[model samples]
Target chain A: MNDSAGKIKLPTTILMIVAGVFMILPFLWMISTSFQSPSEVFSKWLPSKLDWSSHERIWTGSYNFVPYYLNSVKISVISTIGAVFLSALAAYGFARIEFKGRDAMFLVYLSMMMIPPQVIFVPKFIMFNWMHIYNTHWALILPGMFSIFGVFMLRQFFMSVPKEITESAFLDGAGHFKIFFRLVLPLAKPALATFAIIDFSWHWNDYENALVFLTSPELYTIPLGLQNFILENNVDYNGMMAASSAAIIPMILIFLIGQKYIIQGISSSAVKG
Target chain B: MKRRSWIQKQGWIGYAFIMPNMLGILLFFIIPALFSFGLMFTDYQFANPNVSFTGLDNIERLFQDEQFYSAVRHTGIFLLSVPISLVIAFIVALVLNRSVYLKGLLRGMFFLPYISSGVAVAFVWMLLFQPSHGPINEVLRWIGIATPPGWFADSDTAMYAIDVVQIWFMLGYNMIIYLAALQEISAEQLEAARIDGASARTVTWKIVWPLVSPTTFLLLITGLIMTMKSFSLIQAITQGGPSGSTTILSLFVYKTAFSYYEMGYASAISWFLFAVILIITIIQWIGQKRWVHY
Candidate 1:
């Protein structure tokens, strides 16, 4: 039995190590190719020198990444903050407070999650044009702030907070606004953090929406900037790779910092689903 | 009586709290959704006020359109990656469920792709599959194959290349979900199966596999839905080209509306996409009873 167990370990380790390498090979390649010269990219496995030209070109050129990077951070951060606050407020109402037809209304809101965002691009285009927000960051940020999933997830979290806590707070003659800001929101910090992190990453990584809405080169987010880089310098693999590398730095930073909640959030979503 | 009055007062505040989101949803999502249904029947060019009610013309064009048919076919190929990723993720989950070295690190590495920017992911793979001297083809030639597929450069092979990226992209997410389900399985159940003189294969098939079928079911339905709607990676990599061979349904909708300014035609294509999603959802609602072991 011991001998058999030892034998199985070798193949499993080899298999896992190989899979692990495949998982990260693209990221490694992104960094490696970014630093390699055009001539040496396909020829060399790793760059011979730590090249800074590609990285330098992005900042100093006519098309700078400064606006793109700032746009991404600005859009995602604002969207995340608004999403957390508004979702928590509404989810608090649904989870705790009672009103006429509340359950029925909540059911309607929940069903909207089933509607894929692709189905709306046409009318949204018309609507945004009419509203005069087309081709602006507002087009992305406004709709982005309202995540149905965030409301649902935070509702679940809020529901698990004992009702007695809310009841006792109510007895102190405090209004719903005060109780929410003073009691529920503070208690649901972990849930809020989880949603904020997830939402931030999503808006940060959002491409199709940003692609459709933002046409001006200056208003573009990081993903849009990277796509612009690709289109402008189609075969400039070194420059494209450098831009792509720069694009994911914030995401990697977020992942490293909040991976615990990110993983937990994913797991809980599966279990809950 | 006083307490009852206070409860009634709180109800109005509930509405106040919920009003902003409710109105936003109604305006942004519900209105647009209903508006698209209306647009499906119109000859509305985007940003052009000259609109005509060409009832059913767009829908008629959709059925007769050759590009629509190919988008459907590409969507079928794209969805295939979901199941393929699920199987591989399940196997990996089972392996890592046991006492594996660097399990946490491996889990994080795999999940990174799922969370990474789609454009970045697409660009890296484009370089790797750079047909002539790109590393993937180079390695294929090195391994004794005289000719290799022209991945993104060839119309015939582009969809399959996208599948490889989709599979890689979804593997970590599927694995993480599977790992969660696997952790829920009790060890005593596996021990009991082994004690009954069952081989490792028997234990896995009869015990572990059955236990995670619900996760499998959940991932399948959601993954299929999510993968069909995925656009960015394909948009960045090929933009439905080397001749539009990789144009899945969502990309087709994007092109018809934004690229061609054919809002009416795009609405028709997207409505078809929604109908397909509805059918899959209905199937999951019904099919869960038959095979999704709780």
Candidate 2:
């Protein structure tokens, strides 16, 4: 029996290693292709000639990706901050304060999750066009600031906090805003971090909305910029791969930095629901 | 009396906090969704909004449209792939659920594809499936096959290629969700089954499978909705090409509105897709009572 169990372990170990390799292969290919010259990129094995010129061109040339990176960073940071702050406040309201239509309003917020974004794509485009925000960063940032998911997630976290703490703060003559900022915000750190990471990654990688709204090349986010890159330089596989690799760097950084919170956030939500 | 006023003030403040989002949804989401339903009945065009009202003309045309039928067929094919992918994800999740070294690293590696933009991954797959220089055909050549089908270029194979890419991208995410569900199952139940001399397969079928049905159901419903609406990957990879063989409903809506400038027709297509998904979701919700353990 022991021998049989040991035999099973050996195959499982081998299978895991194989699965790991399969999972990492694309990332490895992305990095490998990015460093290759035009001639060597499509080669059967790894690139023979390692050329880093594409990376330099992306950073320093006329159509530099620095602007795209900056646009992504600026939009993601502002929107994430905006979303966290506003959602936390709303969450506190929904979790703690009772008012008319409170349950009904919460249901409305939850129902938004089921409504496909495609349903609103055309009208929202028209709306944005009318407002003259179609081609600006405001188009991207403003809509994201009012995310329902963040509100709902944060509300769940806030509800779990002890009521005694809020009562104590109230007794100390702290107003709602003061308690929200000073007391509740600090306590909801894990939830806040979780939503921030999610929002950042989502906005950073968002392509469809960016594709539709940002018509101008100057306002192009990284995903849009990368798609434009592919359109213009479809034959230059090396350059395209390099651009793609660069675009994914920030997401990897986010995942690494907030790995714990992301896991906790997802698992907690899954179990609770 | 002072405390009552404070409570009222706090309630108002709460409303203030949620007001921005509520207003945005009312303006942007709720209003547009209702307007889209209205647009379905009209011949709306961005260039000619005044001559918009067509009175169910677009919906009538949708039934007769050959491309719409083709899109439906393609969507059906895509939906068929979802179950296969989910099963693969479930198997992988079960394998990974066991205690293993480098588990976090493995999980992250699997999840990398999910986080990256679908367009980027589609581009990589496009290169790897390129007719001449791609390694896929190279491997096929080594396996004693004289000639391999051109993956995305062949009309017969393009939808299948798109399905393969979609499955690869989604498998990791589904696996993670399943892993989470698997962990929630109590160890005592499994131990009891083990002591009763049940085989692993029997234990899984009778115990773990029933327990994880809710997660499975959730994955199924969400996966169906998502797959039905998938456009970006299809656009990036196939462009619904090789004689429009890979065009699903979402891409059809996009092409109809943007490429062909048939806003009313696209709106009709969108409504059709929405109704189909709504029916499926309702069925699943009703069926959940029977199958979903939770």
Candidate 3:
């Protein structure tokens, strides 16, 4: 970072700024278009005056996003909590306790990560339908609870912690559950936080599963609601943009709050993998 | 002996710890996976349950279908984003790794797309690339091009347009990873290269790039895998439209299963999709040894 990076050259700096602008242009357009009146949407780049009507319409009109936002919150929060806890529990067990065929089972579990979620949608549809949860949020939440990637990522983090810490706790006559709750869980907070944020985004942005499983508009997540908005008002660019903005603004806030964790988590996951 | 007893006893509790998650995996993942495999040989439509085993029939259709081939081709085009994104991200990361202004803000800007919901991304790109008067074409026209490409509206260019979105979506992740790898390179090494009178280009190509080959390899494999599996963006925008042009394999499977309720055929295509991913992964694993420095 020192001798070579004394100063950024002009061309490189210009190129970087250009790239950055290109990256953010769509987002800016989305936000700006949301403020344009419907008649002025395609005619101009920026609105003469920012309109709040489009934003207000999302809540006050027949086309409401309140239910979708609430459902997304419910599913992402519940599923993320359930996924983080379950993955950590499994990861801790695999990391700490020595059982026969444990490595073999973990190996099998690791291989399951390659099987794309798309492959099993048909059978999941069948199974969920049979269980009478097909049109329910449980269809998404139940499957979302078990993330093989979460377990795998946490297992890597857990494996790096000194075995002696958990081993000594065992010698103190504490059970695995007690140590897991009291010691291991507290120690793994950073890793757990990282995995929780990752899983939360997955459930939050998930369109395919919600599109397939949940039928009722009342059961729609943010993605489904956005789609329905698009279908009903393809011509209403301002309204559509408003809905899109509403959908992502929370995620943007979350990213701003947790960017440190998200960056660290991504790097660690890549390097360790 | 006490420790042995504890180890033995805790082994049972290990099952307890993993039990809930394992049960979940079985119920939700493993069983469905196996059921899909079985359904590949049978005519199992959702809710019309007169199931009959039709061995090899679905496979035959997969190999013969023109749309299947188009999906395979679109998937290839979609996958082009992985390397393109990696290259661009690597360049951005190299610059950002240096003395740059507002580095944190720029990094966040690039990464915003990856974290933003796919639906918003889809809609935003739609507006940006809207063929008639979208900003992109307006820029092209302003630059003296009489006819710019109809990005999402035209079938011929639709897949490439989606590739652009995918590349933008993945750029931040790749940049961060590459930045991490760049930081790992010792300052002394770069200083040594400069001491030998090497140009910055030579230093980056000969020393820095080779050193971060492992990160590139990691990004390539993971990006390829992830981009291959992702279809929600395509589903959100175009939806295999402009006459079924942007249909990647994942979206194809989604449409087949949910839209048409052809579960058996969908399962078959999905198995093929799995095989495609598996082969790509195995190829990457074997290929990594050739270039991955670490």
User: How close is every model to the real structure, measured as TM-score?
Assistant: 0.96, 0.94, 0.96
lDDT of 3 at A232: 91
Q: Residue-wise lDDT of candidate 2 within A1-273, one digit each (tens)? A: 235555676577677878878876877787898888877866746777788988887888765898898998899899889888878878888988878788899888766666666666777777888998988999899887888888888988998999889877887889878888899999899999999888888888777788768888989888778788888888988887788788887678778788778877876775565
Worst lDDT window (10 residues) for model 3 chain B? B2-11
Q: Per-residue lDDT tens digits of candidate 2, residues B218-292?
A: 888888988887688888888789899999888888888777766767778888888877787788779878877
Q: How would the docking of model 3 be graded? A: medium
Q: Which prediction has the highest DockQ against the true structure?
A: 3
Best by TM-score: 3
TM-score of 3: 0.96
Off by over 4 Å in 3: A1-4, A9-15, B1-6
Q: Candidate 2: which docking quality band? A: medium
2 or 3: which has the higher DockQ?
3
Model 1 interface CAPRI class? medium
Residues A245-272, candidate 1, lDDT per residue (tens digit)?
A: 8887678878888889888888886676
lDDT of 3 at B16: 86
**How do the candidates score on chain B by TM-score?**
0.95, 0.94, 0.95
